[model samples]
Target: MNEALQLLKKYWNHDNFRGLQAEIIDSVVSQKDTFAQLPTGGGKSICYQIPALLQDGITLVISPLVSLIKDQVENLQKKEIKAIGLTGGISSDEVSNLLDNCLYGNYKLLYLSPERLQSDWILERLKNLPIHLIAVDEAHCISQWGNDFRPAYLKIANLKTHFPKVPILALTASATPRVKKDILEILKIENAVVFEKSFDRDNIAYMVFEVEDKLFRMVQILRKNPEPSIVYVRNRKSCIEISRQLQQSGISATYYHGGLSSNEKNKNMTLWTSEKVQVIVATNAFGMGIDKGNVKTVIHIQLPDSMESYYQEAGRCGRNGQKAFAVLLNSASDYIQAESQFLAVLPDKEFLTKVYKKLNSYFQIGYGEGIDESFTFNVNEFCAQYQFPTLKTFNAIQFLDRQGIVTLSHEFSQKIIVQFLISSKEVIRYMSLNPQQEETIVTILRNYPGIYEIPAHLNLVLISKKANSTQEAVLQILEQLQKKEIISYRANGNDSTIIFNEVREDERTINRVSKFLLIQNDLKTKQLESVLKYVSTKNECKSRLILNYFGEQKKENCGICSYCITLKSKATPAIAVSKQIISALEDTSLDSRSLEKITGQPSDQVIFALQELLEYKVIEILSNNQYRLRK
Candidate 1:
């Protein structure tokens, strides 16, 4: 324990461990199988890291997210601790070399995907390493009941079969009792020391609002609680659009989603994390292992499919414990949209079987011949070629990927390379003719050397910034240049590559996954129903509903939530609130965002008052969506 504390003080510059970190570390160092259910920002890494340093051999960490593995490995490396990640997209040769590094590099930690562990070569090589502990991050994924269930995670049990002496430490930030039991059974971990931090975050005022204009409501919420915040949207397009709207409304904001290139994601995340931007509108992909402590708000513009994911994404805020808000914005139409999106994408057995056959045919993989074959899989192209519904097809492929039938490697194609077909002199001549593209051409030429001789990989964000152009314009210019045969360009943006882990079995393939597919479909339906029940139930406290969903029943109302505030505000009559609003706006017009502050009433009350006043022709809405007394 002394040595562990010393490592903590020396490396992390912390004199002591936080919360249950000390106890979890003690259990791990004593070689006990442990399970930790810490909250999102509860320092889960410290529990295994300190013990890994205390032990004699390397710790093999099976994590579900590549971003998470990269982050932890990089952070540890920054502290001069030897850590390496065997994340996806590496060649077999590279994998062997990385495993060799673990053998001889004195590396204390090796992080990898459970899918990688399913490989015979990787499994065999791992058997030789003196693994001290097996740490499973996102351990909740092992549970069929948990959100984000990855079928590959079940393979982690194989490690136990090989390294029987290794102490297994499973860690997850979110899990119900069912998920906990499921995870324990899947890991083959019995009599393990289980530690769970309470899921109740008293500091976070869980707020739910159903409004006709979600954007208007969101702007109001942000204005009311102006601090470092995140706004989660359902899709990539929303990430861009909402952030743009916020920016146009005079807020410093950015966007992030899976569709963005790595450079863009990193740059945007850095901007928001460093307080250069006050708000980040993002897709659900935005918050994995993201622990920015001072985030004052997390607003979801669209309802997530389940309470589990909503809880996780919303939980990203309020980590600083300083009165943060987790706000969910919804509407009557949003519920209909949510149902269509969630239920439509669910892959049933028949749908799964159809997709299975189509995928194999698309790849032209002969029966029992594509066991190890790999192919470039663009979801859009695949859907277009087969005339499958885009969302349903995507969900089907993902289901297969999770079933260990194929690996849909995202962020596997960030490399954008270009080479000039024409000579430098001809390129210069063409650039002279096309003055509009000259700066971008010059930027690419200057940044990437030997582009005339060979293909050189480049970053789109870097090129755009240097060229003083948008990425869209840059790509357009590149495409134009390609048409003229002045240069050959290849840009793969968030495209996925599929590697078949199983041979084509067609009916047999569907048969194997059918039972689980039905079960999973049922699970998703229930989850969506739970989410629907949550948002539509206007009478219940939002905090209590969410807590109860996670099996944390809180009888007391969180007085700051939308329900509690609304319940309390009903005591004041609508006419009385309207009078206050008129008085507050007597001297000047005000927008909805500011009316709540000036009227000294909750947002719901203020909005209701404004609606009534507008109906009576007592107040008028301006072109800018502000309210003023009628002439």
Candidate 2:
């Protein structure tokens, strides 16, 4: 413990370990398989990171997201610690070189994706290295029941087979009981030591408001809590729009999204982190690597896809042990919008089967063949030939990727992004003048939402299908429209690559995994419904509801949430409140609403106080239902 504490102070400059971090570290250091479930901001990384620093040999870390891996590697390198990350799109030569360095170099941490384990050579190379510990970040992804399940994560169990002597440490921000079981079982960790911290934040007040104008409500909230704040939105367009609106109302705000270049992201982040900007309006992508703790408020203009996301996002604030707020705003239309965004885009079993077969046909792969065969996938051409919807078809391909049927990799250097520079009416007039281009122009406007507000990646094949033309024709029309300054377009070479991990009996392959697919989609629906219920429910304490969802039943209601504050105010007999209400009516006859404001008590408490006076015959009700002291 002394040595671990010393290393932590040297590298991270922390005086001591927090919460279960030290216990989890001790377990891992003793070479015991450990599953640690801590909520966001719980210092889960320190549990394994400190052990990695104290261990004799290099530690192997498997994480899900490339961005997360990159950030961790850079942070380690900043501390002058030797660390390396093997992310996707790297040449085999580079991977071989990095592995060689890990074998000989004084590297303490080596981070890579779970998909890398698919290569037998990589596994063989890893077996030769002196791996001290195996840490799996976002361990919940290994579970089929988890919110962000990835089949690639299931392959992490293979590392246990290879490194028979080393310990495995799994960490996640949130996980239900079912997900926890799946992780331990899938990882094949026998006699696992599990450390779970309560998923409760007492300092933050959870609030939900139903309003017709979310923007106006947001403005009011910002004004009320004029401390550092974050407003979460769902799309890039909303990020820009909300920030601009906030600025117009004299609130210093900035916006961040994935579409922004690295420079823009850094600038905006710097503005907010430096306290120069009071608020940051952003999509979900804005939260990675954020360590600011003074954020007094977190307001979500759009609901997240699941409770896991909601809890993580809402947990971002109140880390400084100060009172903070997590606000969620909803309108009547958000329910419909949520369904369309989540359910409509989900690819069903039949659609998934069709996508798999078409993919096999497009790649010219025969049944019982094509394992380990990789090909550059031209998504536009395939979608055109099949006349499939771009959004759902892409989702189906991704589902296959997750199920290990194929590996779908993207090369961001090449993409067809477009945004219309002119209004639809002006474009309609232009299209009528040049009727040859009408179909292509109309198709782009319809398929791509937010094309007018933000640049969107377009599936050229889908556009061609809608226009009843060829990809070449569509590209030509796009170029012509760009030349006329009607739209902005950017494109490069191929977009994605697909490698078949299984033999190409497409329908049978999909059928084999259909049950998992069904369960996952159903879970998505249930998760969304849970969030919907949490917001709509007025009687239950919001904090207790969240804790229950995470499989922790709190004995007492959190006294600060929107529900508890009212419930607590009314739970006691408001004798003083009754006297106050009576005194307010003594000067003149007054209605319940006026007494409410005059007494400065909650509506329920004030009404109960008035009722007590009426029942005791100490007050009289006028014909207009106004309360008056007994005459």
Q: lDDT for every model? A: 0.85, 0.85
Model 1: colliding residue pairs: none
Lowest summed lDDT over 10 consecutive residues: which window, candidate 1? 407-416
What lDDT tens digits, residue by residue, belong to model 1 across residues 429-490? 88889999999999998998788888998888899998889877898898998898888889
Model 2 stretches with alpha carbons more than 4 Å out: 353-394, 404-513, 568-631
lDDT of 2 by residue, 1-631 (tens): 9999999899889898888999999999999999999888888778877888887898899987777888889888999899999866676789999999999998899998887887789989999888999999999989878976887787889888888889999999999998999899999985799999888999999987665457766887899999999999987789999999999998999999866645467889999999998999988888877878898999998878899999999999998989999999886578898988888889888999988888888888899998778787767778999999876787788788777677676532246889899997898899889998888887888888689999999887678888899876887888888999999988866656777777788667888888888888898999999988898787899999999999999989889987887765535458989878877877899976677678777555666677678889999878796879998
Residue 363 lDDT (model 1): 80
For residue 422, model 1's alpha carbon misses the true position, in angstroms, by 6.9
| Runs off by more than 4 Å, candidate 1 | 87-94, 412-494, 567-570, 574-631
Q: Number of the top candidate by TM-score?
A: 1
